[model samples]
Target: MDNQKKQPKPWYKVWWFWILVIIIVLVLGGMMNDSSSSSSSSDRKPKAHKVSPFKRTYKVGQVVNYKGYKFKVNRVKYFSGNSMDTPKSGNQYVICNVTIKNDSHEKQDYNEMDFQLSANGNTTDFGEILTSGNYENNTLDSGSLDKGATVSGNLIGQAKKDAKLKLEYQPSFLDDKTINVNLN
Candidate 1:
């Protein structure tokens, strides 16, 4: 046999070289796809979150309509309890003159207990002290309202003296929606 040397194969023709080229092509294609997708997303405006329609606040004297019933807070008054009944120390009575109109075709039940007073981080519900005060005649009572009928009365609760208060009315026990009236 003659003494002959064989030449090595070129880098592009090697098996490992072709495998590395395929990997690089795949990585570059993935990078390009990611960049294009990000650019497209950045071109569109962001979506806005929706707000609930049932959640709302109203000022005094504004009519709040809920489930075909119309409610209006005519006035707010503060008082010191009478001799027969007195509030706790550093507390006073908050009274709201509210009018409710049944505009629906059917009769609706209403109660003074539906109203609440929130002040100084405390919530006050209708209590016995409210009925014993000098304003007893003005207090609201539980009754059924017929269509086209209107009933106006006072809702009372005890709160801190001179504290800013919010009168809240919840029409139904099962519903979380409330109508808030600010009493400054």
Candidate 2:
């Protein structure tokens, strides 16, 4: 009997090997095609952004409805502090008596910081001066409000005594929309 060893089949000639090679080639080709298409599309100009409509400005004593909340500036009072609690030179305490109501179905947050006082080209944030007499113990507090709950208090700021003022409300940082209340 001849003792010649049988030659092993070449890897390229194996059926399973060819099948795997074909699958790899197909996958690579598909990936290259997808990358080329995406690169071409990236050269196109982006779509224009839609502009938002203008909102109406609310006057003092008018209820402003925004983002499921109701805001009203009842009145604005000026105070020339007594000898013990006077404002800075050429400035006086400007107090805004306001009411906020949560009209949404869920709880909402209320903060004095949400209100800003703008006057004479300057903007002032909500704050309290211990010397300013606490505005009659009715300063607006920061807290969470339940649905339909209401809170009323004073937002105090220091500004020129004769400057026309406006109150701005922007409770959410994610939202750029602001409600302006003219407090001349």
After superposing candidate 2, which stretches have Cα over 4 Å from the reference?
1-54, 130-136
RMSD of each: 9.6, 7.9
lDDT of 1: 0.82
* Candidate 1 segments exceeding 4 Å error: 1-53, 130-134
Poorest 10 consecutive residues by lDDT, candidate 2 = 45-54
Q: Rate the local accuracy (lDDT) of all candidates.
A: 0.82, 0.84
Error of 2 at 54 (Å): 6.3
Q: Write the per-residue lDDT of candidate 1 for residues 1-184, one digit (tens) a residue.
A: 9788788999889999999999999999999999998888877856576443257777889888877788888998888777876888998777888999999999998998888888965777865445564577877888999998999988878888878788888878898777777887
- Please name the candidate that would achieve the greatest TM-score relative to the true structure: 2
Question: What are the TM-scores, per candidate, against the unseen true structure?
Answer: 0.66, 0.67
